[model samples]
Target: MLIFPAVKASSRLPATSNNLHPEKHKDLYAVTEQVIARAIPLWNLSLTPVRLPLVSNRIKFKCPEYDMYLEDMSDSEGPRREDAKMSTNEKSAEKNGSATCRTSSNRNLGILSLVSVPPHLEDQYPIEGPRELKPDNTVDIWREYEEDGLQIIAKLANIHLTPEKPEYEGGTWHVEGQLHICASAIYNYDSDNLTTSRVAFRQQSNVQRAELKMSYPQGDHDFLEEVFGCEQGGSGVQDLVTVDNPEGRLLTWPNILQHQVQPFNLVDSSKSGHRKIPALFLVV
Candidate 1:
């Protein structure tokens, strides 16, 4: 399996593979890169990086006013301690924002709170807001979906893995909703006490056409299999890239390519772990 390198949040471009030889990959692009896209005009290139001087540094916790409910978000779980006074149920409740380190009943897990301080947005611009509307845009590919209306289907879910059931077997190769799904977005809100996990993508390739174009006379299409490192007999599944999924990360992609969730397990021997995600599918 090919592991992709980590890309920072500022990246807004197609990725070039280090593994691919420039000469060979460019030559294959004529036969393999079948999909070409038209430009869809977008607005607002500036006004980002909201570095407001007055409140940027002042905001410590997202909602400091609600500190009564939260213990403050931390990058990692602190040292696990035993709570002798608490019941077994209370101890296990640690997974749901519950804390064993609390000294008394004054503190409780804030995870269940319906409303709290919004996440601190210093320089980050979350795409969920209504910021990217193009008024003067010409007719584009998505114009059909936007003319009347379109709804985005969302699925809120979490996977819990314990010592008893530690492994999350990889998902099957499929699109988000088979046909109607145009785009999909997955937000990894929380992934605690788990090993590194990844999501993979593969796209259908024009095997017969590519073979005919590249090696019609010789009757030898070995390079199609060897160069791309894929078996040629079956349906052409061109492995694209595997994305490393981490906490607070948002991954979005068009639904034309099939994708799957890679398997993951708990990092610790006894501790329980879970990944909380909300997947959104856009159907036209």
Candidate 2:
């Protein structure tokens, strides 16, 4: 009979701390800052700064002209003072151009002049275009795949998105976030050849979340309905031609991915069957 009494569970349990989950507790600012830092160095290497020669700073001057005046004091008796004055006035009028007195500051002096760049300096620094990610550029990932018709190029650019607020209120709710994606493509349109040569700057975004809460206004939801229910058809041709009614277009990630594959596939198929495809290209 030495059995201990069964421990009764307490009605009230001790409250656990409301600490944030590790996965859920993301520092968005820190994440964004890291993304920027990683992105900037890659961009800087791609674009070289254009330099201009400095000009010399100098002062200029201008001068004014005046007529010479002579007084006839000794011969004042014959001609009188009035005649002398008249002569003086006549001489002053005969002067062709007024003399201009100019100081050094009056003349315009260019700040700097272009001088011959020293041979040593020229050798050290040469005129160049933007730093390009050459086919032979030494990037760990890029190099391995470059010859295999795969490439990655990145640049820095600004992006803007619509729907200022996070919530969907009156109008059709559209979620948008903008970011610049610097891209390089390895594909040829003509014979469907594959090689990395094309570079582009794109403004792209993702709609992470969307919801329709309430509707008091009639026209508020119209745009949303239209966006959600739009049909995918082009000039003159439809996927289903005979059908009077066309299916509404649905915006999804798969559709976007499918649209991007054509160009890539064209080049990929044309490449020599023997060449080894890089793992990164396969993942992308």
Number of the top TM-score candidate: 1
Query: Candidate 2 on 1-284: residue-level lDDT in tens?
Result: 01112122101111221232324534522332233333323333322121112111111111112112223424542322232222343345446432212112211211111223332454433323222334344323333323342222212221112233212121221112112222221221122122222221221222112222222123333322332232223121111111111112111111111122111112344233111111001112
Local distance difference test values of all predictions, in order? 0.50, 0.23
lDDT of 2 at 72: 42
lDDT of 1 at 29: 32
Model 2 RMSD, rounded to 1 decimal: 29.0
Weakest 10 consecutive residues of candidate 2 by summed lDDT? 273-282
lDDT of 1 by residue, 183-276 (tens): 6767787799988768999877676664543312143343345444468466677788899989866676666668999999989959899998
**Candidate number of the best lDDT:** 1
Candidate 1 segments whose C-alpha is farther than 4 A from its true place: 1-149, 226-229
